[model samples]
Target chain A: MIGTLVQTPLYQWHVDHGARMVEFAGYSMPIVYTSIVAEHTATRTAATFFDISHMGRLRFDGPDAARFVDHLVTRRTADMPAGRVRYALVTNEEGGVLDDVLVYHLRDGAHASYRLLVVNASNHDKIARWVDVHRRRFDGQVEVSDLTNSWSMLAVQGPNAAELLASLVDCDLASLHYYTAAETRIAGKGGVISRTGYTGEDGFELIVGANAVVDVAKSLMEAGKNLGIVPAGLGCRDTLRLEAGMPLYGHELAEEINPLQAGLEFAVALDKPEFIGRDALVAASERTDVPVRVGVELSGRRIPREGAEVFLPAGASPIGGVTSGTFSPTLQRPIAMAYIDRSHAEVGTELTIDVRGRHEPASVVALPFYRRPSGRESTS
Target chain B: MKPEDLLYATTHEWVHVAADESGGKVATVGISAFAVESLTDLVFIELPEVGRQVKAGESFGEIESVKAVSDVYSPVDGEVIEVNEVLRDDLERLSQDPYEAGWVAKIRMSDEAALAELMDHTAYQKQCADEAH
Candidate 1:
C-alpha cells in the first residue's frame, strides 16, 4: 500500500467525497476533490473553498510589536494599517528564504481581537524557533505566540466569492478589498477574514473557531451551489497558483534560494532601514551575471517535470534547472518554471527542455500562465 | 464492460483474438474498465506507430489523464497494423466505450502461439480479484 501520513481536518469528509488523499506538509490533504480539471475551471469561473487550517498562524503583541516584526520579516509592519495585509518573505542570516508568509496585521486581540502571521505549515517549527530567538533580543518590546491550533482557515476564492460569502458574514465582505483583513462573525464564530488567497482571484481567507470549521465548509458549499463554489482539493490549489504564476515553498522558494534569484525582488524592500539578510540580498542583486527565475511554456503536451535541464539556445551546456512544471488546464499546453543563467532569463527567449534524453522546444514567457479578474475596476 | 471471453492484463489492457473482416488472426486490443477508471480523464493519446513492428508485452503508446501519465502496454506479440485515429483526436471516446469505440490499436499476430499465452476471462478475473485488497 502506498501509505503516507498527515491527516487534514477534513480527512474523513475527503474519503466520503471520493478524494484521493496524499500527505503534504504533514497533513493528508485532498489532492483532488471531485476532478482536478473541473475544480480548476470552477475556481476560474465561480468560487471554491479550501481547508488551509494546516497552515501555521502566529501572533505577536506588546509595546514594541511592530518594530520587532519589521526587523525580521521583509515587509515593514510598523507602517502597515491594522486592517491591511502584506505578502513578505522571512529570510535567514544568509539571505535565503526561511519561508514565505502573509502578515495580516489583524485587528483582533485578546481584548482588541487578533492579528495573524500565517506561515507555511512545514516551516511552523522553524519559524517558531526563529521567533523565540528574536523575541529574547526584543524581550520588553513584544511577546510571540503560536496560535496554529486555535482556528480553522478556509480560502473562499473566485469572481463571485464576495457575493457568496457576504450572506454568511455579518460585515460586508465585498468592502474588505484585497490584501486587507477584518474581525467579523461567520457561522456564529469570531472570525478573522483576510482578503487574501493563493489563487489569483477575488477571495477571502476565513479564520474561524477550529471546532466550527466543518459547519462553515458545508454551509458555504451549499450556499454557493448556484454560484459555483467548488470544494477544491490541494491539487487545484497547486495548479491554480501555478497558472497565476505564484511560487510554492518547495518548488520556487527554498532555504538555498533567495528573493533576487526567485524573481521576488519586488517584495524585498532594500530601503527598509535594517533587517536580517538585507546585506546578502544587496550583494545578490548587484551580481548582473546571476541567474534569474523565468517561466517556460512548452510547445508540446509532454510536461517537463522538476530536475529537468534547460538547454539555452546559445549555451554550450544546460543553463538552468526546472523548479516546477504542469500541464496547464487553462492554457491547454505544458507550462514550467526554471532558473536560467542571466543570459537566457529574458522573456520571449526560446529554449529547449531536456526531457530524459530528448529535447522539447519551449519559449520563456511572462511568469503567470493565467490571471484572475482583480477587484480594482479597470478604465476600459 | 465487454463479455469476458478474452484476457486482461494488470496494466488494464484486454486482448481478444477474433477473425478479422478477412482471414488471418487479428488481435483487437483495448483498455479494460479498471484501466479506464484508473485514468479518469482521456487527454492527448499517442497512438502506436501504424505499420511499425512491436513485440509482445512491449509498450505501444501512451495515455495521459489529469492526475497521472500511463504507458499503454501491448497484450500479445504482434505487428502494428492499424490504430484508432478517431480516439486519438477525441479521447472522450475512451472514457465512454473503452472496450468497443474506445479500442486503442489492432495488430496482426506475429506468432500464433502467443495467443494461447494470454490469460482467459476467468484467470484474468482471478488476477484482478487478488489485486483489489
Candidate 2:
C-alpha cells in the first residue's frame, strides 16, 4: 500500500529526520516530525519550514492568458501587475466551490503574458480537468500546462522568515510586499519567491526545480539553525491554518458549500461581466436563510469536532454543524468554525455544541481566534 | 507500581487487583505508558461515572487529542466504584505518570475469570512490538 502513495522530493529527508509519515491526498507526507504542539509553537514564535510540493502548480501563457484566467477565477485578473498574487476561487456551474487557489501573475520582460495558479493537492486532478474542458473555447489562443511535477514548493514561515530566508536567496525579501512574488535565484538555481503563506505569521513560499529543491531546502535549514527553524509537518499546518481562521477546501469550502456562505465574499468579484458561476453566486448571495460560517469557542477544554451539531439551549433541533475544529496551540483553547443559521451567527451569541452526545457550552466569537501582533495582511 | 507486576489488556489498559478493606477484590485500572505516548498532547479525557456496571472489553470513557478521539475500554467485568476526577482537567498527569497517579478508574470485580484472560508484562511487550512493526 505504501508503494502506491506519492512521495515528495524531501520524502527521504523527512524519514531520516524521524518524521511520522501518513497518507495525505495520495502522497506519503510527514504528519509530524516530533509532536504537533512543539512544531506549532515553533512556527508561531520563531521559524519553520514545510514541504508543500504536493500542491498543484499550473501555468497559463500565450496571448489569451489574462482573458482565460479571468474567465476561470472569481477575481479580476486584467489589472494584476507583474509580481502580483491574488487569492481566488474556482466555482462550478452550480456556484459550488471547485477549489480555492492563488493566482500569480509574474510576467518577465521576455514573456508577453504568464500566469501561474496554485491549487490544493487534493483537488489538483479535478481542477486540471476542469481547466482542460473549459479551455476549448480559447483553443489555439492559449496554452495550459501542469508544472506540479517539474516544480517543488516549500513554505518558510514565522516572524523571522524574512531575515532567515534572506541568507539563502539572492534578493532582499524585506522589500517584498504581502501578496506579491518575485523571480529569484536560490543557491544559484532559478525559482520564484512569493510573500504568501497559510499560517498567520509573516512568511514566504518558494518554488524551484524538483531536482534542486532538496539542496535549496538543506541550505535554508542550515542557514536558519541559529534562528531555531524547525521542520514542520502537515499536522501543525492544519492547526495553524485553523487558528488563523482560514478555510480548508474539504472542511470549510466543499462542492456543496458556496463561497458566499463560507464568508469568502471578498474573494468573489460578482461585478465581473461573465464567469462560470457568477449567476448562481449572485442568486445565492440574496438568500438570507442559508447557513453561514461563524467561529465558536468552547468554554471548556472539550473540542468540537467535525459534524458535531450546534444547538441553542431551548431547542432540541440542531441548527448547524462544525466544519473544522482543533485545540489551538496559540490560543490555548478549543476553537471551531461552524455553519449556523444567520440569525444566530452574531458575535457573543450563545450556542451549545453536541460533542459526542455531551452538550458543551460555546459562544460565537470573532473570525480569527488568534492574531499576530503586527505584519498582518488582509489578502485572504 | 512497576509495569512488570501489573496485568495488561490488548486494548492497552493496565489492571492491578488487590483485596480492599472489606476483603472484596478491587481492580485499579489505567492506560499503559505506550498508550499515553501514542495519544500525544492529550487535551480532554471523559472519566466514567462511579457506580456504573461495565462489561469486559466495553468502552467506558473517551480520550481526545487535538486531531483524534479514542475510547478507553474497560478490561474487566466490574462495577465502577471510583474514578479519577483530577484527570478531567489535568491531562498532563496521564503522560507523566500513566501507571500510578494517572489511574483512570477503580472497579469492584464481579467476575474474577476475566483477569485470567489478560496478558502479563512480557506478552504485552511482544504484542506492542508486533503492532509497531
Query: Which candidate achieves the best DockQ against the true structure?
Result: 2
Q: Tens digits of per-residue lDDT for model 1 on B1-133? A: 3647767766778887877777877888888776776566456788998887777778888886655567888877778898999986788888778878888898988777766667777887777677643
- Per-residue C-alpha lDDT of model 1 across residues A1-380, encoded as one tens digit per residue: 32556565667776887876677777777777667888888888888888898899888877677777788887676788778888899999889999999887766545552346899998988999998898887746687787788777889988878888878888876567778888888876778887888887778899887778878888888889889887888877877888889999988899899987888877899888888898888788788776678899988877777899999755569989998887788889888888888877778998998865568899999978887555441111
For model 2 chain A, give the 10-residue run with minimal summed lDDT: A371-380
- lDDT for A359 (candidate 1): 87
Regions more than 4 Å wrong, model 1: A1-4, A109-114, A136-138, A313-316, A374-380, B1-6, B19-25, B111-133
Clashes in model 1: which pairs? A6-A28, A108-A113, A108-A114, A109-A112, A109-A113, A109-A114
True contacts kept of 2: 0.47
